[model samples]
Each structure stands twice: as structure tokens, then as C-alpha cells.
Target: MPAIVHFEVRIDPERRDEAAKYLAETLAATRAWPGNQGIEALVDDADPCHILVVETWATTQDHDDYAAWRTTPEGKSSLGEILAAPPSKQVYSETLPLGL
Candidate 1:
């Protein structure tokens, strides 16, 4: 079954534009990574600096592997430069689409 992962982060208000560019450049690797189905980044309406990243993967294991890699020195991303607070994440599995 496919898995859905939500990654939410609060960006520095002064670096909103930079965050856009940074996420684009960084997430490109994720998009190309094995087992990645798709990914999207969205900004909050009430808070311009708040961003949510939605990612789809082939399975929970696939997402876990990708996430584990991000913690490594080689896979580390530069999110610290733009973030105002630590990021939060949620995982969902066993999806059942209802043709919405």
C-alpha cells in the first residue's frame, strides 16, 4: 500500500523567498529518490512562513529509508538555514481512496 507523509516547518519570515528556492532545490533529490511516488510543498494561508510538504511513497519502509538517509551527512539538507523552529512530521498508511 502507498504511504503518505506530511512534513511541516516554520520558515524564517525574512527568508520566505529563500525557503521556496531551497525546498525546490533540496526536494528535487527526494522526488528522484527510489520509491518516491510524488511530492508537493504548500504555504499556509494564515501564516506565510509556515510550510507543509506532502510526500507519497510506495510503502512505509520506502519512506522510512528515505527519512533515515536524510539524517546522514551525505543526505543532510540545509533546512536549518530557513527554519524558525524544528519541523514536525506525520505518517499515514493503509490508504483507501474513494474517488474524491
Candidate 2:
């Protein structure tokens, strides 16, 4: 089953456009292992400083691999300026009770 990965980042309001542009380019250029599906980014309407990135992958392994890459010095160097603070994140597996 695919996994849903949620990413939340808080960026300086004044830097909103810059943050979005950075994310857009980064994700576009990112390459992942097999089983990677797609990614979507959302900006909070009520809070311009808050941004969310939702990603779907064919399995947890793909997400793990991508995450490991993000922690590397090269990765940090690329994304360092776009962040106002550390990002908040979570992962989930979809479930339907009663086979629904």
C-alpha cells in the first residue's frame, strides 16, 4: 500500500514566494528510488507562513530513502536558506475499517 507523507514547514511570511519557488524547483529536480508516486504542496490560507507538502509513495522504503537523502550535507546546503525553522512531519498508512 502507498504511504502518505505529510510535511509542514514554517517560513518567514515575507519569504513566502521564495520558499514556494525553492520547493517547486527542488521537488521537480528530485529523483527517488522506485515506488515513488507523486508529491503535492499546499500553503495554508489562514497562515501564509505555513506550508505543507504531501507525498505519496508505493511503499515506506521509498520515503525512507528520500528522507535519508534530505538529511545529507548536500541536501541541507540546498535547502538551508528556504527554511525559517525546522520542518514538522508525519507519515501515515491509509486504513478502511470493515473493508470499506
Candidate 3:
């Protein structure tokens, strides 16, 4: 089953809108990456500088591979430039809820 990745980041207050625009441009490569199902970025309603990225991949391993590549210079994303600090990430498995 596919895994869901929640990536949270806070952009530099100075970059603001520019950071959002930059992310839109940069995420194209991620959307096209192998095993990527889809990607969506959501800005916090209370804090425009904060962003939450929801991503779906064929499997946890797929996301892991992509994450490892992101650490390398070749596949590194320019996000660090606009980020105020390091991002947070967590992977989750889909689950069914029992009826009450």
C-alpha cells in the first residue's frame, strides 16, 4: 500500500510569497520522480510562512530513496535557501476505522 508523508517547514519571514512561488517551481521534479503518486503543499492559515507538504508514494521505500537522494548534492532541493529552519517529516500508513 502507498504511504503518506507529511513534511512540515517554515520559510524565512523575509521570503514569504517568494518562497511559495519557488516551491511551486521546484516541486515539479518531485512530482515526476519515480514512485511519486502526487504532492500538495498547504500553507498554515495562521502562519503564512509555515507550510505542510502532503505526499503519496508507491511505498515507504520509494519515499525513503527519494529522501536519501535529497540529501545528496545532485538531487538536493533549494528549499534550504528559503527555509527558516530544518523541516520535519513523518510517514504514515493508511488505516481503516471501525464503526462506532
How do all models score by TM-score? Answer: 0.91, 0.82, 0.90
Query: How many angstroms is residue 63 displaced in model 2 relative to the true structure, after the best TM-score fit?
Result: 0.5
Write one digit per residue (lDDT tens) for candidate 3, span 1-100: 8999999999999988688677887788779889999999998999999999999999999998988988888887887889999999999977788886
Question: Global lDDT for candidate 2?
Answer: 0.76
| Candidate No. with top lDDT | 1
Query: Pick by TM-score: which candidate is best?
Result: 1
lDDT of each: 0.92, 0.76, 0.88
Give the Å error, residue 18, model 1. 0.5
Better of 1 and 2 by lDDT: 1
Candidate 2 per-residue lDDT, tens place, 1-100, comes to 8998898888876677788678876776443446668888898899888888888888888788778876787654354476789888898877778874
Off by over 4 Å in 2: 30-33, 94-100
- Give the lDDT of residue 32 in candidate 1: 89
Model with the higher TM-score, candidate 1 or 2: 1
Tell me the tens digit of each residue's lDDT in model 1 across 15-88: 98899789998899899889999999998999989999999999999999999999999999997889999999
- Deviation (Å) of 29 in candidate 1: 1.1
Candidate 3 weakest ten by summed lDDT: 20-29
Return the candidate ranking by lDDT, descending.
1, 3, 2
Q: Model 3, residue 9: displacement in angstroms?
A: 0.7
Error of 2 at 64 (Å): 0.4
